[model samples]
Target chain A: MNLETPALIIEEGQVRRNIAKMAGIAAACGVALRPHAKTHKLPEIARLQIGAGSKGITTAKLAEAEIMAEQGIDDIFIAYPIVTEAKLERLATLSRRINVIAGVDSLEGATAMNETALRRGVPLQVRLEVDLGFGRTGVPYDHALELAAAIAKLEGLQFRGIYTFRGFFMNGAPTLELEAAGLEEGRLMVELAERMRAAGLEVRDVSVGSTPTAEYAARVPGVTEVRPGTYVYYDRMQAVLGSCTLDECAAAVRVTVVSRPEPGRLVVDGGSKTFATDVGPGAPPLHLIGYGHILEEPDAVLERVSEEHGMVRVPEASPLRVGDVLHIIPNHICSTVNLHSRVYLQDGGQMRELPVAARGAIT
Target chain B: MNLETPALIIEEGQVRRNIAKMAGIAAACGVALRPHAKTHKLPEIARLQIGAGSKGITTAKLAEAEIMAEQGIDDIFIAYPIVTEAKLERLATLSRRINVIAGVDSLEGATAMNETALRRGVPLQVRLEVDLGFGRTGVPYDHALELAAAIAKLEGLQFRGIYTFRGFFMNGAPTLELEAAGLEEGRLMVELAERMRAAGLEVRDVSVGSTPTAEYAARVPGVTEVRPGTYVYYDRMQAVLGSCTLDECAAAVRVTVVSRPEPGRLVVDGGSKTFATDVGPGAPPLHLIGYGHILEEPDAVLERVSEEHGMVRVPEASPLRVGDVLHIIPNHICSTVNLHSRVYLQDGGQMRELPVAARGAIT
Candidate 1:
């Protein structure tokens, strides 16, 4: 079947290979591989990675982990701060189905979790999130220690360990340098874990990662696990960071040219809805090359995207035309993948005939 | 259920009230109320509108209509240009379940439709989209007569009527003047319909509208239908255009404070995802009142939002704590509603929950 435009397409072969590479790195360092399923919410893809020797799955929400557990995947980790009552109930409900770990950054948040867990008669496992560099979320680096110690004293909660996302390590100098910074961050977590263990708390699970720091986390001796989500479907940012090549990107959005409203401008069906409006820090202007690089056009980038229209400014010499199909590697694969309801699995270089199951996991 | 923060919360009472107002306007105009379901894909909402006297439902894609059909909605119109094979198949499938009216612009699009109708043995109802002003989609108004003539020649296809989305017409002029322009556009469509009928084609359907032009369309002599979606959930753009008051908006995204890194800054769980980045042309700069106007402080605008963080830079003297739930009116209600998995519905003043059913209708 010809899959529709603005559709997410994932090659099973490439994804399996990528999973193996990540699992291998974790195995080499004696670290557990908890691949973040938020990148590819499709449980089938999660199963592929789980089948290939993963410790468990990592989610950004409790609802997502519950969905995974319902599908028979037990071990789950929610790497997000859940404080709201609705999510706490969802987290509590999921404990009966699997080994769930939720993230926390504040003592008030921990105390709330402890109270909720006690009320539900289930011990909630929490991994305190430390602010490394990505200042979006997480406690301050110094405050992480205080939060961890506070979590250690909280009742009806398990202080599994401490975790930090090295999204800031995505770009710096070189891959080796990024890895070294990642190592330093991991060492800090180890020291924090030691501090918690000395405080009479069981701190066995030391988790830290992201696609950029996957290799670095592997070499961190004291880290018990690594959480790399986008590795399952490496994106343009990953390629720019020397984390993976463009060819290693397993996920791509297929779109069809619908209009040539003006010269040098080709309007495609896939717009912000298909590709997403994620322009991470330092992102090259979408229109500079393209909003996303055209997989069919090795040198072409999707310059800009409106709501229902993607304006692909092509060079006068380019051979692209209206009605022609093209694959796009979006800037951030996870966000783009989340935009679509389903993904098609293609065999290596084969056509995406039928839709793969477990695609829309919006929890 | 504790509704998800940064969630699309629909006031069911107000939404039903808006639907009744539009349905009454269409009924008074003697035109069918084919409300565009692209605004809120909830089957329950669609049924309520249809039950209140709408002639049918309208969608941007066959996939959306199909989703609505699963929840028992019939008589759907796809008002966007669809030319791909997969889309055509879905359109045909939808036609079997309901009376599907697909939009066409060029001869190529018409030929594809003719071929699909012939190949599938189904008479596909077609709506010729007339581009009155919005340069995004539709055949040019100057070429409408030629396209209508050509469409009349196609076999196994019924020319339902002509339609144009008077989107953002609120930006055109003041209320009365803009309504006059809308009437003029309606008169043009009436003349176009007469021209189609002169060519021996049935011109029973002459649809032209949007929230801004709904009041004017109710009086246009030759208009047979009005398609206004946003009236069900008015936005800041609508309120600013004098279409409705802030209190009349049927939808608001409920978001809780997630971070307060700085004293004057309040980070909420809602960001571009729930709020949407759909700022129309000539629309006021978001938060000119400062990023977004707080729901509690019908006085203060939210101000700015990153991908995952909403920057509510408030007065240091303000008592906006880190856990206060705030309701935010989106710049465009349609896009904000589309960003969620479900809409949290409320009755009267208290929020009662309901499923969105058709949230990810992006096929």
Candidate 2:
């Protein structure tokens, strides 16, 4: 297919390889993989992962979980804390149709979920999100047990287990010290599970996610599940951080050089609207700069991106011309994927369009 | 309405006032106003602008034009240089039903448009985009005449005139010196129009767009039309830049505080995915920092935004609790608007949802 510029392109071979590799790792470590569907937001990709041995799927929002449930994906875990009455209502409705897993970090949020479930005549399985240094959401590790115990005691709520997302270490390959620290973090989580069990709480699903530490966490003695979102479409940021090789990156944006304004400066049709300006934490050893990486010209940098203009800086002697299409590996694939309604899958030199099923499902 | 958190809220009163104010500016300057639809991307809003005495509407992509055409919006000018064959075919089809005007800066793009128009047995109205120091796209003003002349000579193509978007000055209100610079830029555009007329070319529409410069450019001697998008939804960035007052900001993201991690640190459901991290060219005098401004708490900075979490830094004494829904005025309304599929219009204290019809129409 002669595709349009600023189109999201996914390599099917690379996607399948990524799925199998992560699934194999999880299996070897005696843990179940519930790959996050928020990255691709496509039911097709989620099905492929399940076919490759994924136990279930994970979503970032209730809307995404609803979309996945509509597509007949029976198991879904919304890895976000659902607090408001409206979201809890939607979650209760979603739970009736699927094996829904909700996350909560506060007693109020948990009580709200329990109330919604009771009103809807459904059971809400919840996992307490504990802070493992990400500092974004999740209760402090010290406070997880209290919230988990309270959630367990709440009516219409089944406190399944605890989950934590260690995102700060996503920047690069953990140094030996960092690796030891990760193991220690996982040990603490396992210890939390042991403490909960000792307190007569049924802690079944000890989940750990965050692409950078999935492998290390999967091997933890008590961690039963992993929920890595970016593995299906590793981005430039992940490659720089040694999470995956550049060749393993499955997602890319195809853009055309629309204007050659100056000798060394060019403008591409894709910009921040397509390739989101999420300059993932730059791991110093890799030296990746700018917004994303250009496949045709390795040294060229997409220095700046406005709404619809990507200012590419290349060598003055570069032979680039208008109308030439180039592929860009975005800094963060998840946010970039959210920018497009449809994504093209390249298979056997043919491009196939797949609707991004849950794009803009931030609610 | 019991709504989900992290939703876009548009104040209907402020939006109508914004439209009327901009329309009044154009009418007083004796120029036609073609408000850019890329900001709101809703046909309902486009109709409101037309109702408020807009000549037509300007779109950023051909897909938006098609969507508007479907909604019975007959006149549309795509302010982007689209070159690919697939897009030209769509443009040709769109032109069949609507009065479509395309922007082109190079001879190659103009020729392609002419060829497509010829093949489709239709006439294409074209505009030569000139660079007036917004180093994004557009041809250097010096080289525009030659391309315009070439476009004028092409088959099935009508050279409608020229246009420029002074995006560089969008950061803040023009200082006295910057205002003088803007007037000088407009003067040059008028001179360019005179040169084209002297060269025996029929130049009818000399258009200028950019919310910050629209009023100044419309008063230019020969500028027949002006397009300003952000005037419809004056965001925090515009307020700080003196484009509009904080009370005049029409659009905001209504998010709920999900987690209060610490005394001074709170997390909201809206993050980079909702409030895009468009820091913008921060004007020093205004002292705006971070992503967006909280309408409820003016001094509370949305310090950091990740994929699904917004880390807000407020005074420790701020009594923010979970489930408190707050409105945020984003830095760049256009970018922030594109992040959602549906936007809520607060009409007379009641919120109504409107689908963002042209969102993700980047191609």
Candidate 3:
């Protein structure tokens, strides 16, 4: 495919290798690798992950899960908090085709899930999500025990287990202590599961992991599963967050030099639409001076991105000419990948196309 | 629409008023209005703008232009520096349906477009985009004449006029100077047109406008048209850019507070997914704060956004429990609107539904 500049290029070999490597790690750890399909909505990649030992998959939206199930891969986990009536109706239909695991933190939400399950005459599976310091979602650590117990007692609902997304486990968390904290969080979750068991409820699964904390949390005695999405296409943000080195992060948005009308400036076709404007904490607004490190210097920063162009402030003088192409690893790979409908593969300068199966799972 | 949180809302009344006001301003200034359809990306909004005296519609993509043409829009201008082969093929198809004018800044690009048009056995209409001090995509002012002349001489292509987006017109180019510079730029375009004509070529149109410069640029002497897309839905960035106030802004994303695990920390269903993480030239990085902002106060800063959750640092020591909904005015409206499939509307209180008719105009 002769892709326009600034297009998200997904190297097929790297993507497959990333998919398989994570699958191997999960297999080695003895946890059901339900690789979060939310990271890459590609049905083909989901099948690859499954082939590589993934028990099933996970999505962020019902529509995405539905698409995956339609493609014949069942047993899906939608990690998003499902609260809408429309979503519940879809979830009800989804239950017949696949084993669906939904996330819920509130007692009211748990009850609603139970109610929906009863209406469908099927058991709705749920994960008692705990806010393990992300401050994003889930019950507080103090409130987790009660929520877990309530979920365990809810009728027409199977308390699958407890799950938490340690997305906030970024560079802010020191590496040495980060793994320690993750293990301790797993311990607390294990304690919660013990409480569920003491209350005469079966707790089969205790799952948790982000790309940053999966290795640490996976070895924790009670964590039966781990879901890390960004490991597949580690981004500049992930590199900064210390999950992977620059070379290990194997996806980039390839863009063309569209306008370089003057010195100390150059614009590429990839803008907020292609690369996205996601700068992780402590990073510059844009990795400027170079939208990317020209691929050779794989660890270099992608210093700039505007709406329809990226401003790469070249060093002294960029060897790049007006039509030179460059590869840019987005700061946040997951969101950037989600912005495009297809990914390109560049092998020996030949670009192949790969559909981003879950590009618009915005619901 | 009784929209849930994290929903896009557009007030019909405000949108009507904004469209009409811009149309009115352009008419009063003796310029034609060609409001960029790329802003609303909706056929209905195109109709509205056309009904309000827009002579034509401008789009950034051929898909958008094709959609508009299918909806009976006869004239359209694609204002991006389009050079892609696939897009050119679509442009050929679009030209068969509508009066398509494309932006070209380079002689090579113009020649390529003419070659494509000739191969398709169709004529290509184009405008030489002049870079007027803004260093985005365009021929520099000094070089615009040469590019224009070369394009005019190219077979199967018509050199319509000159164009430039005043994006380089500073972040918030003071409204007074904005209009003055626009008028001066218009004069320059008109002078270029005269120079081209003296060199035995006809110059027909001179167009330019964005949300910030739309009201002023249209009044520039010799300016024939305006293309302002975001006017229909002014975002917080536009408010900051002094284009419109929050009230006059037409759209906001309605999101729900899903969890408040602790005081001073609240999470909403809307995150970077709904309201993208585009910020201004501020420091400490805009964070996860309570609500992207109360719609009533567009300038009230929204501090944080995660993928599935928006962590809003509650401004005051107040009780913000679960199940509360708030309106989020994204930092950038154009990109945020593109993320959703459809927008649920309201006067923000009541509810209705509208398909963002042009949401997926990705060519």
Candidate 4:
């Protein structure tokens, strides 16, 4: 292929297959699929997911939802606690035109959104994010019922459901046992929903699941929907987590060997700038040995990276030349995709470029 | 400030001060300052550097040089090796318009550039990158003279000088001894240049130095130029490395506290997507304890980051509330700047936006 190095390449077949497989799993489990659009950040991929039976799309920021809305995606859940007045105003405007669901974990954020909804004359749909062990965001599980009741009482807001994100945790512990962790995540969210219902609050949706936990979590009785983003393009981390086989991984970065610096070391044209450093080589749970896995030469480990160069360590007898081209499956696809403006899609023998329309929508 | 959260903010006065200070350092050492544009990736800032007496600008890719050239910056040094044919075509086109220099650490890369130059009938100015123990790129120190001689023999290539990047290393060991490491980096390059000169090669430009090593490296007698990219916007890593003070950090990400998840944890509206993960919290030499430093709450540590949320560990008695704005100095400015599309420049009371024009120019 006569293409530049450090280019993001996505296999059309693998993407479609992965999307269908996840959608099938969700359907069999009687759960809606709301694939996180933040993974690809491409309207085309979002459309494909929607075509394959996704109920809606999930984005981490309102700016990303606005872009998706502009591309004619009607349902978007901004799965973040957006507090700023400017963003609230934009969210209110977006809610007027589409089914925009806002995430709120505190009364301060709910009150701000309620005021904006009242002023704009558009009732905002909100979901209470529960802190189910992953202590990043969301209201504590103990305080979630009170917070949900308070948000439901707000004049211009409709408390639709509850959601939480616990990627792979079993009984508050990070674990590799996907089934056990996923079931716990689903049960916790379901139990919270039942509690909210008993308290005379309407809790229609119970959303949970990440790419690693979606299959098992969705199989649990009460998980209404799954929001697995990276399943569309599984990466090295997912492969190690046993969520998907390496063959099912769709996205790979095409890079050229720019220098054979030593007998055992080869440097490529991509580095942290090409494949992001969000998922490290030796991160816990999945102690991935390298920055990425080279598909052509599985023995070669992309050991280190600077801003613009990837230092690959290979066996001394390896025949990789200075100008050899290789494909590397990054450790995390979402962060890697965010680093590029466009990606090349390979459909059989044909190749074309697609803009990552919401690439820098980090507002 | 009525601005969106997770916005990159740069102080105009501090930027000017940093530019002047680095230029002054290079001038004092009788070396030319060719500030690396990869840090800012802004033509406006490149023009400012040139206006502040920078000899030229250095970029990591030819595409960035093309962008800089189009913006009327006449001289550029693509500090990375250009190996692919597609990039060589662009490099040849860029070379025709400006004083463009290419980096070569291997014969294969040089031969490709030589073929392109020969085909286009343009002499490509080349610099030999020597590996002085960084172990990332560049030819090995023992083989530098041979590579230089071979590169000099290329028909369409002009061997101008030698350069290497060894940031904060002392006698092949990573250390916090800045002065010793910087001087050693400079002396090694100078000695290699002397050897190449003795072998009857014209080594006019012995370029070396990174943001942490530029001051001492430029003081070496034979070092003609220095390329310190991040000195323009000193980040937390630079400050910890003794390169700059916290007050000298010109760029910061303005984020708002969106959730008080626990008594000791405050979640902000920024994360790995906002402040990149390229430079980690516990990286060596500078064992930075957090993702970033919140200026308002010096005791708080921005401990963990998901895609869109930063988990800050703060004091129990802290008075920081949701919707309160905070500015965080990132660990690495270059990677952080690359994550944004535009940045807000604050000039006293006035504020404006500047595009990161060459942000995704990885090829």
Candidate with the greatest DockQ versus the true structure = 4
Query: Could you tell me every candidate's TM-score relative to the true structure?
Result: 0.85, 0.95, 0.87, 0.98
Over B1-363, each residue of candidate 4 has an lDDT whose tens digit, in order, gives 567878999999999999999999998999999999999999999999999999999999888888888899999998888888888888888888999998999999999999999999999999989888788879999999999999999999998998888855534466787888789889999998998889899999999999988999999999999999999999999999999999999999999999998889899999988997888888877788999889999999998888888999999999987899999999999999999999999999999988899999888
Interface root mean square deviation of every model, in Å? 3.1, 1.3, 2.8, 1.0
Candidate 2 regions exceeding 4 Å error are A119-121, A169-181, A280-287, B169-178, B280-287
Give lDDT tens digits, candidate 3, residues B315-358.
55555556666777776778887777677655546666767766
TM-score of 2: 0.95
Q: Which candidate should be chosen as best, given lDDT against the real structure?
A: 4
TM-score-superior candidate, 1 or 2: 2
lDDT of 2 by residue, B127-172 (tens): 9889876677889888988878888999799889999887654334
User: What lDDT, from 0 to 1, does candidate 3 have?
Assistant: 0.72
In angstroms, the error of model 3 at A341 is: 2.6
Candidate 2: Cα lDDT at A112: 82
Q: What is residue B292's positional error in candidate 1, in angstroms?
A: 5.4
True contacts kept of each: 0.14, 0.61, 0.27, 0.79
Cα deviation at A126, candidate 3, in Å, is 2.3
